[model samples]
Target: MGFWHTMVEVFPRFMPVLLEGAVIAVEVAAGALVVALAGGLVLALATLAPLRPVRFAARAYIEIIRGTPALTQLFIIYFGLADIGLGLPPLAAAIVGLGGNGAAYLAEVYRAGIAAIHRGQREAALSLGLVPTDVMRYVILPQATRIMVPPFCNFAIQLLLATSLVSAVAAPEIMFRARNLVMETYLSPHVYLLAAMLYLAVSIPMSHLTARLEQRLKRSR
Candidate 1:
C-alpha cells in the first residue's frame, strides 16, 4: 500500500517531463534513421565502386565506426566538433552520432543484401539489354530489398535504444529527464521505474515489428 501510494504521488511529477522527453527521443531516432538509410546506401555503393580509393575510404569509415564505441562516437560528434568550433546543437549531434554509428552497421547490411542477389541476376539483366542503372533499378535492388527487410528492422530497433546515450550530451531525451528527476527528488526508484516503462512502451512495438519480419524471412526460406 505504501509503495503504491509513493508511485501514485510521484507519477505526476515525472510523467509529464518524461513524456516530453520520450517524444524527443523518438524524433531523434527517426531523424537519425533517415541519415543511416541514405548514408548506408551510399557507403554500400562505394564498396562496389571500380576505384580502389573509393573502396578503401568506405572500408575505413565502416571499420572505424564499427570498431569504436557508440558513446565515444557521440562524444566525438558532440564535443570533439565543438572543440573545433563546429558545435552542433544537441538534437543535431544526436542525429549525426547515432546515424553515423548506425550507418557503419547498416552499410554491412546493405552490402550483404546487395551481394546476396545472385550475380546471375545482374548478368541476366545485362543480357536483357538493360543498362547498369536499369539492371539495378529493375532487377538487383528489388530483390535485395526483400532480403534486407528483416535485418533492417533489427538495426532500427537497436538504433532506437541507442538514443538513450544522447541524453548524456544533454539532448533532453527520456534518460536525460529521468536523470534530472532522480537528482532533484532523490527518489531514484520511482523515477527510474517510470523511465523504464516509458522506454518499454516505445520499444515494444519496434521489437514486435522486428520479430514479425524475422518470422516472415524464415517462412520464405
Candidate 2:
C-alpha cells in the first residue's frame, strides 16, 4: 500500500486520539504558565530586593534553573523525587518541572520589564509620599506592563511548545500519544507529521498574534 493511502486510512483513527492528547498539552501549558507567572514575579521581586543576600539568592536560582536541562529537571521531579518518598503524579510533575524551569526565564523577563521603566518615575512616586510597595504597584508596574506584554506572549508560545517535553515523563501530552500511536501502527512518519501539524496549528496563530501585538504597541508609542 502507498504511504498516502496508509495515511488516509490511519488519519481518522489517529486524529481523535491526538486531539485528546493536545487538550492535555494545552492544560499542562496553561497550568505551568500560571505557576511560572506567579513564581517569576516573586523571583523578580527578590532579585530587585534591597538586601544583597536576597538578590544573590534569586540570581542563583535563575542561573541554576537556566543552566540545567528541563528534561533532567522533570526526571528529578518525577523519578528521582519518588526515590526520596516525594513522588508526584506524572501530570503534576510535568507542570511543576516546566513551571520551575520557566520561572527562571520569566524572572529575567519580568526584571527587564521592570527595569525598563525610568528611575525618575520611581523616585517621583517615592517623593510623593508613596511607600515602596505602592510605588511598584501603581507607578512602576503599570508602565512596565506595557513593556512586558509582548515578551510574555512570546514566552507563552515557547511554553506551549515546551509542553511536548512533558511526554518524557509519561504525562500523555501530544508527543507522548504520538509515540504510542506510532509504536502501535508502525507509521512513524505520518504519526509524527500529524503531531507536528497539531503543534503548528496552535503555535502559528500565537506567533501572528504576538507580532500584531508588538506592532500595535509600537504604534501606540
For this target, which candidate reaches the highest lDDT against the unseen true structure?
A: 2
Best by TM-score: 2
Model 2 TM-score is 0.97
lDDT of each: 0.90, 0.94
Residue 206 of model 2, lDDT score: 98
lDDT of 2 by residue, 120-199 (tens): 99999999999999999999988898899999899999999999999999999999999999889889999999999999
lDDT of 1 by residue, 1-221 (tens): 98779999989878999999989998999999999998999999899888999999999999999999999999998999999999999999999999988888899999999999999999998998999888987898888988898888887877878889999789999899999999999988888899999888878988997888788877987
In model 1, which regions exceed 4 Å deviation?
Answer: 216-221
Candidate 1 structure, TM-score to reference:
0.94
User: Each candidate: RMSD to true structure?
Assistant: 1.5, 1.0
Q: What is the lDDT of candidate 1?
A: 0.90
Residue 159 CA displacement from its true place in model 2, Å:
0.8
lDDT for 10 in candidate 2 is 88
